[model samples]
Target: MHHWRIDDARQTLVLAATGERLPQVVYWGPALPAQENLATLHATHAIDVTGGMLDANPDLSLCPEATRSFPGQPGLIVRDGEGTPLLPKFCYDSESNGNDLRLIYRDAANGLTLTFIFALDPDTHIITAQTVLDADAPVHLHWLAAPVLPAPQHSGEMIDFSGRWCGEFQTNRTAWSAGMRYRENRTGRTGHEHFPGLIIPCTGATNTQGEAYGFHYGWSGGHRMIAEELQDGRRQIQWGHAARMETEAATQFKTAPLYITYSPSGLNGCATAFQRHLRDRIITWPKPDAPRPVHYNCWEAIYFDHNVPALKDIATRAADLGAERFVLDDGWFGQRDDDTRSLSDWTVDPRKYPDGLHPLIDHVHGLGMTFGIWFEPEMINPDSDIHRAHPDWALGGEDQTLGRQQKALNMALPAVRDFLYDRMSAILREHPIDYIKWDHNRVLPMPDAAQTRGSYALIDRLRADFPQVEIESCASGGGRVDFGILQRTQRVWLSDSNDALERLRIQHNAALFLPLSVTGSHVGPRYCHTSGRMHDITFRAWVAAQRHMGFEMDPRELTDKEATVLRHVTAWWKANRDWMQRADILRLDSADPAVIAEQQLAADGARFVVFAGKADTSAQIAPRPLRLTALDPNAQYLISLANQQDIHHLSRGTPALKSGPVTLTGRYLMANGITLPWSFPDRMWVLEGKKL
Candidate 1:
């Protein structure tokens, strides 16, 4: 037997192989002692054979084989060029181990090679694993999973995400059983309906305490996830590109990186690891040292009605409201007056901008804010000039149903990517633009890995040519969000629905894997256009302030008092953004189910801010004391109610926090927690704390 182990500060994963068979992960959890013997541990990891079972259990190898009669879902499924299923039994060939581990296995009889690669980030505590398959001849791949990993037997339930357009990141909890909890997203993009993430809490794990494991399949292309509990009591998780995504036969197939982490300190531990890994390691920021600017997007404000003078006036007002980056959303190009036409034309609409975009961009610049424009390069309207010229360029059958009056451009074609790059590059070359709101408005007709790869290529090319230009991945908001898309973009439009009340829950839940630096949360109009629910300026602005702060509403609609409140919140966001950008968003466990609260704890652990949003009415009469996390119990902190002025006159009793700032130990604060003045539903409370 051969055994190997990979260790980081927080976790360790051990793999073992018998004879020349492929290796399997035998142990994965909290950091093990450095002097422990992996070989002895692997030997002890085996189970006894039962009456109804075979004499010995088949190894759940890196690529479990149907040839070996493995009872669980195999790690791979493939066929020859003629569509004949080939069940090759991969054998251990070679291995490489260091900070990263690479193991190769070969099936000489079938002329196939299977490889598993693993890399652990020491600081972020995230483990990245992937699988690659190479064949001597062309083959058809039905499914290719990333390096398969064992699921914790102690985990009672598994949490996966599923939701609709505005309602993204809704968690679905499934109890562990003797069968598979299978989920597949064939929407072509990382659909809002099925986010590629899973969290398994060991037994009684909560958001703040206990042990948990997190996994995210980082692919913008559609994906499939399997959480299977075999009859032998072994559990495994498999994540890969959606089955049959590769339409054509090929010699090689590869799975996207699967990020894994084990958290002994509960779900927040997993959250922080993913957050730091994405922000500090995965993303390539154009201006690393610059603060995340206050954003102002125009989609909700004006829709497709683009008048140059009106937009200029709006830009000025947005700047006055403390917006440092003005993003001109959709309908800026291709004679696009509405969503019905001019999608892939990719040229400035002469009707909308008589003098090109210079005057408006200049006005935005004059107001001391950078300019950004929108583009939907991967889509085409049937009536668009480009679509008219190249009808064959669109993907799927001609009679396929349309979304948003448009079809996805055939991104797999080189000509299509070239057309988008050329048109987008021309605009960037001419305009003094620093950002692009790269929007993918609709899902593809079918899931295709090549199409997703093609889209990545175009964005990669654009990023290379204009290294300074930032991109925001917006797929009708939250549809295309994942580490794969985030690799090429700087920000993400979290949701199209700018309803602050809706956003409070969305942002809170999304904090599991998203950081404030890339999550774009915008304050919408007083009367939300999507949900048609009106919210107070204080509540709206604070909700926006929770992440990458922005405003999507018409500044002209804000009353004098409303504008002042917005400006104050915007200023506060600006002041705290420097540290908040790198801060860890810790979701607090609210005793009241009605409240959604989170603490943005600074990276250095010196300060933090808590946003307690009362999403609905509480069952009890008074407000519950909200507890904080990741604090030094012995340290004293100076706590103050940041939005004490927003306290309504109906709140008669003066709570200690309502009157003035209080100095308290972290122990007392975390144990007894901080109680605030009573407030009605739809309101929010902001509390600031600093180490004293």
Candidate 2:
């Protein structure tokens, strides 16, 4: 028997080959002893398809199937040239290179070959799998998945997310059931409605208790994630790029890798694994150690009113409030006063800046802040010059549906990709622009593989040419949040909505899989333009400070008191952002449903910060004690309020701070917890703790 098992630091993946069939995962969970073999496990754990099977070995009961079964979705689907399903038998051969594993299977009838690639990050306990197909003869490919694995047992609760526009990354949980639960996004881009990941926690598991497993689809385009429980109590979770092909040459194609990890320590354990994998392997930060700049965007300030004098005034005021980057949003190019026209033109609007953006750029630089600009390079307005010149470049044709009055460019076309790359590259060469807020406001009407590949190619080309230019991925906000895009861009605008209260839930859920350093959080105006909710400036700033801090308000309208609060928040962020960047994030469980608590513990066990906010509190005067986590039990810590001044008039007898810089042992803090001040709705508090 030819079998293999790969062991990461915490888990083990066991694969076995039985005769001519492709190898299947027999076990994936907490590591077994080093001397354990797959034969013993398979004899005891493999599904028994003895006499009750129609196909002898029932396909539905198999661990991984090449085609769909009654129990779950197929991991691979392909058809032939004449529109017939190509169900081929497997011919297996295996090999290994370093720590990576490769298993080859051939279909002699269809002249096609499939290879399953597997690798594990020894440190993070992340298992990666990818599927590749090769064919010598003409074959029409339908759909191909990365890889699929089945759970040993069907006892757990499924956790996922759903949201829209300004309200993204809303968490949802459901008990494991027999029927299939599928979440899919066909919006061309990863829509804000659903995330491309799933978490399955063992029955009755808490944030830090029991066992949990995470499955993340690495593709950034349209995707499908499914969790199904079979009649026999076994569960299967599968994910892959959601692409359809009627009849195309199947010479070679590879599905994006799907990442899987198991955590005995529950949700927080899974989160830590994902964060480490992203920061260490996925995101390529320009300055990983340096703090992200506090940006002040001009979109809300003077939308489409792009004049040099007005922008200069805003920039000056933003700098006075410690904004290190000033971004000029939409309406700066070719007749782009509104969303209707001039998207792909990529030229500075002469009417807005007669001197070709130089005066505004210089003014921003003179204010000691980096200059940034916004662009929707992959979209074209029908009224713009680019569309007029290349009407056929639009995806789904010009006659199809339009979003935000704009159509997506056919990124798969070499001509279109080159055009976008050249035009965006030219802008970088022409000016001292330090950042690019790449926004994709529309979704693709059809799932064209070219669009995703092409968009990625264009961004890659631009980044390779201008290494200093930082890019933010904004697909109508939180629409393109994934490891694939994060690989090319520095940060993501978590959502378009700047309502602080809404942002708390959005940021909290997103931070589960993404590092706060790569999430773009902004302090919007007092009256949120999206939600129309008015929040205090201090409340807004405190929430934004938890991530890559920025501001999306007009500084010219700020009151003197508001300006002082903004300045203090920015100063405090600059002083503590280093710890926030590298800390291990932990979302604490609260007995009260109204309160959300999050903690960031420094890697060295020296410091940590906790952010507690309430959307709505009960009538009870005293809130439950907030237990802190991820601290060294032996060490002592000194605690203080991040915002010492009672900006919101917090109750005087708050348990978090009863005296000046109260000191407590980490063991006590983790076990006993602390109480928070009673305040009105939408109130937040930040507590900082330093090892003593």
Candidate 3:
């Protein structure tokens, strides 16, 4: 349970608790208010959020997040001398978040006391708790890695990038690094298993007089976050293990459907700022229990040029394998084969679908699956009818029209917005398209190719009018990804690159800013798109960790063994979905070749730790120290599992098990880890440590 209080100005809702505040997130703009001066928060896995107890937009007023604190407890009802206890503390050291609320419990229990600072729009705040349970109904005791830091305070209406932050010591753990040191694999592209996308950059060292200890990274939007080193060179990022839950916003007059505000402050202020911008940013799902689709796409198997029947065959096979959704890639749209013309058609190709998309969709639906189509609405081809119809709507001059793919559409015009709106809406309303893979293929072009107020205004307009539909923003991959789109779309296509190695980097890089829920990742078989570098099929499958997961391959192309493995893996993922969503992600590897591995567990002690030794595959017999402080100190559990070779060569190609808590002594776990008789196996392997 989470609680909050607003300040006297009723703007910032000071967060009281949120465990280990290292949550990487992105934001689009200020919240939209339906009524006046109230905000509403949301909880996932729940049925619905639309009810009588909510508002449209909350006030995203400026408040101190880093330099502030919210004083309160979940079950404690201590009131102000004369009134109710406000969530926002009168005095603040900096922006604060829900981390304080979480740490309160930890501190009370003698566990490590974690602290986080953040700012929210005066209107609303949201807290999401890890409600995942183990297969047996117990919570897996997962390890927490992200650290909490002060939310930057930029001089703006809404907090954005401040560029620099100070004030550490207050949280006072006094462990880890002493000064500030930047993390090498901030993007997590190392292709390691156990720690695929961990971006916990900066180690704390002693800082001497605040002499530049903070490091910065480029954000998709103009927004960015900073991790400053204090007088002691301790490197810390913004608020950690984000448990988002904020107050409900009151109704306000309607303006825009949703409005996202960018602070010169950067992305760190997003959640806190969300408090103010809650009302309109609220996207009520038509069906609360909308099962996140189990999907397979053609992009990986056949890129943009894949023919319709090939795609349909892929869809048919995918459906047979329990996939619920099928998405058609490019090439299917307009005269898109060579990217020369036909984009404006927005119509199905005659030769491809003969009977139009309805038939292809019918075929997919007939197989008891939902159909999805990909579209690049904000773009237009030079040879397109719409572009030729209104040449003035395009951004470039005579013949020099920027052609990232054919001629790009100039989205900066109201006419363009209307054109896209009418075309897209009509398609959705008329088709059996249950899902849409909305993509934005190219960057904004040398910056100013658009004739209107640049791309920002265009995006804003499209977002405002494009509704009742699911949209995804793709920048020829992950280039233009940001929170702005998240405010309007259901998910963002993470990247065009699908190679597992590339994904290991891309996903990690993207997760540094966006939440896992919105990052669409496909388990590509072998390897496709991103270099086509093939590793092992199972190794590729291992990359899926509940982030809107799916695949982009021809099911028919899978080997018998590969298919069996995929089926088992998918089943396991769904079974463990709770843990993946609710627990803290502890990524253990750096993408470097010499050393890389990944280990993630849920509440009760169940974890998936994979070690893809990159350096000397010289197997070590020394028991690896498996951290177990996240679990009960005295409770002993058993270890179960074996490497691929051990399973195949020794036990009829299945996991081996043993009884013991993998054996631990004192407060630390003994390293009796993998006793590999050989070097890192060239083949993919798995080791599930079952609790004894």
Candidate 4:
């Protein structure tokens, strides 16, 4: 028997193999003593045989083999060049060292080699794993999962996500069953409907307590996830690209990295690990030491109306309101007056700016704000010049249904990719552009792995050439957000709906996986364009401040009072952004169902800010005390309500929090919780606390 173990401060993972067979992860959980025997643990991990089963249980190795009669879904599915299915049984070959483990397996008869890579980040406590397959000759890949991991037996339910265009990250909790809980996103992008994340919580786990396991597939393309429970009561999870997404035969195939972590400190532990890993390890920032600038995107303000004087005026007002970056969203290219035409035409509109984009770019620069331009590179409209010139560049059938009046470009074609690169690179090279609001407004006609790889190639090439520029992934809003895209881009436009009420809920749920630093939340027009809901400037500004603060509404329409409120909020956000950007967003469990609250605890445990948003009226008349997390029990904290001036007339009661700053022990704050004055629906209370 052979055994290996990987350990960090928070968790442990042990793998074992018998004879020459591939290894199976025998044990994984909270950290054990360094001197513990892994071999004995592996031996103790075995299960007994029963009727209707084989005399001896087959090891559910890293890549479960059909030849071994494994009951659940096989990890790898492939075919030969002539389309004959091939079941390659891999055997132990070799291993590597260091912080990462590379386990090599070989199938001599099939001329195939398999390698599973595992790396655990000591700082963030995230385990990153991937599987690579190599063959002597071309083979078609149907499905190839990352290193498979076992699910917790004590967990009763799992939480996945399902959402729409504006409503992203809505959590769906389902009970564990005898079979599989399968989910597949085939939109050809990391879809809005099915976010590539799963959280399995132990029976009584909450946001701030209990043990939980989190899994996220980092691929931006279509992906399939399986959380299965065998008849033997063992559970396993597998993540891979959508089945048969590979179009042509190939000699090599690789699964995207699967990021998993065991959270002893509940769901927030998983969230913080992912958050730190993404912001610190995945993203390559252009300006590392620079603070996150406040963004002002002119999409809702003036869609497709690119008048130079009007834009210059808006830029000036936005800068005056504390915006440091100005993004020129869509409608600057081709003859694009509307969404229907001119998607692939990457040139500046002559009618909108006859002197090209220089006049507007120069004006934005004069306003003391960096300039960003928007592009939909992976899509082309039927009325576009590029489509007219090369109809074959479009993906799928000619009669396939269109989304947002646009068809996806055949990114798999080098000719198509070269054309897009030439056009977009010319703009980036010529202009003093520092940012690109990269948008994918439509889904591909079909799910093809080649299309995603080609898109990734284009972005990678662009990033390498213009290393100073930042890119944001916005797929009609929240459609293409994942670790794969963030690996290249700096930020994500969280959603299209800027209604503070809706945003309060969406952002709360999304915090389970995303951090505040990479999430873009904007203060929309008083009348939200998508939802038609009107919110106060106070509520809007505070909600936007929860993430990468920005504004999408027209500055010209802001009332004097509203402008003052926005300015103060923006200033406050800037004052604390350095620490808040690195803070762990801990979701507070509010006794009142109507309140959605969270606490952003600084990395050093010195200070924290709690945003308690009253999303709706409470079922009970009085407000419930909200609890905070991750604080020293004996330490004393001075707490004060930051937005007390925004209190309404109805909130006349003199709650201790509203009266003045109060000092309380962390034990009391976590147990008795903080009480607040009653507020109306769609309102929010901000509390700032510091440890003494």
Candidate 5:
């Protein structure tokens, strides 16, 4: 067998090929020494079988061939116009760059060519793979996957996420059982039900120790991830964009790239590597040097009761509470007083804004805060003027299901795409809009490739024309949060539910891949609109301060006491926003499930912030000693309470926490955890420390 291999600093990928069979990856993980021979290593790991053995050398699953007996899912599935399956066989050609590798195969009988490409990021150990297919004549492609690998041995449990609108990013885990476990999202867009990332923990792995492997898909449209266990006790895993393909003349097919990474230092290590890669490579931070603005969105504050005078009052109060951006959410344009009608109409409602939004925008600007508005350009109500005028623009025929009283637009059509883009562009050109809260309220039934392509084209054109305007992606909130969408927008609304308790967990899971700076977290009203749970104002503000801080409540209705807390929280965020944006997040492990802790350590080791929250109390009354992570052990530090009121209120019915500044070495703090005063349910504390 001929062999080829690529080695980055931390990992290695080895490929092998026999006479005329296709090349397959035999080894991929921790790096081996350069002196070690690839051929010898493949021989040592390859399974050999005697007569009548189903697990023969080639079929023993070193990464199966499409037509062979590896028995899991195939990497490629296609057929010709004559209804015959197109199974690609090996061709004798391959090539490699320094950290990239490519292999070519073909089915000459079917006039089809298949090529596989792999690239590695040296620093983060992220390997990206893509597949390309070329056909001399028309073909029908049912399913095409990027790349597949044998699941590593000793991997115990699989960790994934599942949720709905208000309950986004709920973590789930199940034992790595024997059959096939698959996840497919056909929502036309990344749905809030599941994120496009998965983590497999090595046996007995924890948040801080052992090893973990991660997989993430870069596609934003319909996608699938599969984990199949074979009879021989091996597993195959793969992921890619999910599409229905029928070849056209002069058209080529390529699958979206899939990314994989491994870390020996466990889940935290995996998170740090991904966070670094995303912040440095995938996401383009708008105003990187500036702190994320403290926004006040009017969705929950005033809902559809948006009048010029009422909005002006909200703007004045929002600015007084230190909000830097005042966003008028929904009901400003069209006849959109309610969700039942008038989506495609882009003009401002004449009755609500007789002066054409200028007076309100001027008022917000005069208050020293930027003005932003909401737009759901890809939706249309059947009762709207645009829909009545152009009835063919909706996704399905008369039998289509309506979401939020609206239907999806047929973005695949050029005329429809042009109309939406022109309407949005005209608004930007006429108004001094600082930001746009772009929302998608529904999912397309059978979305076509043209629709995805058209959406990208429209966004790209809008960005090119208005480079200064920032956009936020919100699909019922947190429905479309992925690297693919983050490339065009600056921030994502994490979830529709602003319940503080739910957000603590949602934000924690999201921070696994996204930086807190790019997640939109806000303080909601005492009675959460979605969850219907009431929380203390202090608890809500403390949680929201960790992300791109915003307030989603009517500030004018806040009592004097609540107003004071809001002012304090905003002031604290302003003071620490610089370090928070650039810090490395560390999720800490606690003995109690109800007690969650996280720490943000500055990149330069100068300062750090610790957040300890208690969602519920246990049988014991005494508080446990909390140990901090990600600190310089040798350095001395001065620690103090960030908000004394937090301690005063939280410690009211329990033991009193010692006040005043304390000095301790980082080594001692990490090894021997600090014991704070007892706190009850629905309480949180913020502590800050500086190097001494």
Candidate 6:
């Protein structure tokens, strides 16, 4: 079952059973426990945050303010929330004097969907409650029923782990996220041992010490994901990871958690934690239509202002070199370089190509290839033809409407959203275009589009508009990446940070519950982003190969050696697409920067391994016993590899892998580990194995 074992400290829960359909969703969280002490909690009134009765009650605490609450009514409100109304569920005033919180879950029963509300209180150590009906129509309730974080005041003060934790944001290049923190017993008497839900917010409250923070990092951007925060002296707590009642698609959410020193003693607990339950279903996008293998991009070659011929040349070279789709990154449509004009025009620049975009599409298609184009349609240039034609289309700002690139669309506006729908749909329908790299460049600096009239209606229109389109969400690089979006699209561009080793951390965190298919991991060049780490192209590709593998560099620019290696890698992913695209991944040395991820598909499953030797101090690696990840225990796998040398293998498999009762690890041949060319670039190979 894809349910959570919240009662267990280890949180044992299955994500998906083999042969399960993709885009599978599973709910986790301990079933509501019987309340030993149930009592009536009351508040005079609840503020409507969905712009319905939207207003700032300076009297009450607001978001980014830990103690403030975005009060919801006694019942839930779920109107086919397109994007505004934020979300169906919201935090209401819990009796802890608004400082305390109670969580509520609302489901329309139409889809068995759920919404959350977080009301947090720091004073009496008392967290209160609510829940809305799971009936048809809008659904709302108290956002949080149980205290995700125990009231700090009631708990012993021997050690307060609750404080703002800081770390790098997995997506945006220029930001850091911080949230409240609190520590729980390693093993608690209740089901949860370490903690129920640990949150580190970007914006929240602080003391006169000027240390209290707010969950404003991503918020100031476009506020796609909502978070609330506050501080209690050195100890802080936050309510982040909030979804707008009006939300995007479901996805592998990179709940970018932060870890900081509470008392300068350094991190006192395990760096890992889980709040959500595993989704039983896997999400699958159709394999690359043209590449035959999952495609990659070379935008690294041309960020924007990509010259037509240059791009054409890149596409031709990539296709010849066995590459699939050559994605044209930002700068084709609007007056992009400086963000000036023509966003509503969705046309190929006449100057860039006298022949128009059709020629390029034709050229790529002519080469037995597919063409992909990128667009930040959600945004508008302050000086674009669209804005000029209809100024009202842009979200009107009183103080100043937030704009990413000159101007931003009031996605909350029906006409504006319809304009987008018509423009993009018409473009794709008219052109020979096979793929659309739909990107949301920046979070609305003023995410109050919902503040406008009919904003949610506009969002509904957009959702209905782009079903056939293969859109990839990019909140400035993976910030908007999530399961909500996944339901509509095939994959997510994991993180904008192209650090290969950093990817290990991200992919690990993501795959902890997400399926292997939804991840879009690309093999990029060395100049990308190196956090003082050693990264060989081989290592990068190997790490990426585990997911939906693709490349980000222009093949024409590749060194002779690099090109040769990439060609082989491309062929490998193609030949072993069956295994690479679908398999339970096994990593031999996950902790080491260098990792070897092997996958064994169904017996009829393809077998492949992504070898990234990031941690290679020596040229030689001792191969040891290798344990299979998703192979049948009793099934015999005839692994065919090795130089006939002293290739020391890995020592052993996880004890679970060795257990016969566990089908995933049992039948598969358990070899120690396989060693590869430590010096040579990484490799993706299709190993022929037989089921015992």
Taking all chains together, each candidate's TM-score versus the true structure is 0.99, 0.96, 0.58, 0.99, 0.94, 0.58
Off by more than 4 A, model 5? 1-8, 48-52, 59-63, 96-100, 243-250, 649-657
Task: Please give the lDDT score at residue 31 for candidate 3.
Answer: 34
lDDT of 4 by residue, 1-93 (tens): 888888899999999998888899998889989988887898889999988898888778788888888899999998888999998888889
Most accurate candidate by lDDT: 1
Better of 3 and 6 by TM-score: 3
Candidate 6, residues 366-401, lDDT tens digits: the string is 777777778776666666777778877765463464
User: Local error of candidate 4 at 387, Å?
Assistant: 0.9
Candidate 6: regions farther than 4 A off: 1-293, 296-298, 339-345, 396-407, 446-468, 529-535, 586-635, 640-692
| Per-prediction tally of clashes | 0, 0, 131, 0, 0, 102
lDDT of 5 by residue, 1-692 (tens): 77877777777778777665677677877788888887888777766566666756443322245667556677767777776776665465555565567777766766777777888788767777788878888777767777677777888778887789888988788778789888888788878876888888889877767778877787667777788887667677877666562223323677777777877767776777677677667666556666788999999988998888988998999999999999989998788878999998998889889989889999999999988889998889998999999989987777888889998888778899899888999999998997999898887776455566667777878988888888898999998887777778888998988999998888888877777777899999989879888998999999899888999998877889999999999999988998888787777776667777787888788999888888787567677777776677998988877866666544545322356768888888787766666666777877788998
- Residue 142 displacement (Å), model 6: 7.9
lDDT of model 5, residue 272:
72
lDDT score, candidate 4, position 310: 94
Each candidate's lDDT (Cα)? Answer: 0.93, 0.81, 0.42, 0.92, 0.79, 0.41
Lowest summed lDDT window (length 10), candidate 4: 56-65
User: Which lDDT tens digits does candidate 1 get at residues 1-692?
Assistant: 77888898889999999988889899999889999998899889898897999899998877778899899999989999899999988877988887678899999988899989999899999999999999999999999989888899898999999989899999999999999999999999999999999999999898999999999999999999999999999998999999999999888898999999999989999999999999999999999999999999998889999999999999999999999999998888877888899998888889989899999999999999999999888999998889889999999999999999999999999999998899999999999999999889888999999999999999999999999999999999999999999999989988888999999999988999999999999999988878989999999999999999999999999999999999999999999999999999999988999999999999899999999999998999999899888899999999999998999999999789988999999998888899988998999999999998
Worst 10 residues of 6 by lDDT: 261-270
In candidate 6, position 132 carries an lDDT of: 22
Residue 336 shift from truth in candidate 4, angstroms:
0.4
lDDT of 3 at 6: 31
Higher-TM-score candidate of 3 and 5:
5
lDDT of 2 by residue, 145-229 (tens): 6776775474557889888888888888877778788887878787898788888887766676668888777777888777878
- How many backbone clashes are present in model 1? 0
Question: Model 4 off-target regions past 4 Å?
Answer: none
The candidate, 2 or 4, that scores higher on lDDT is: 4
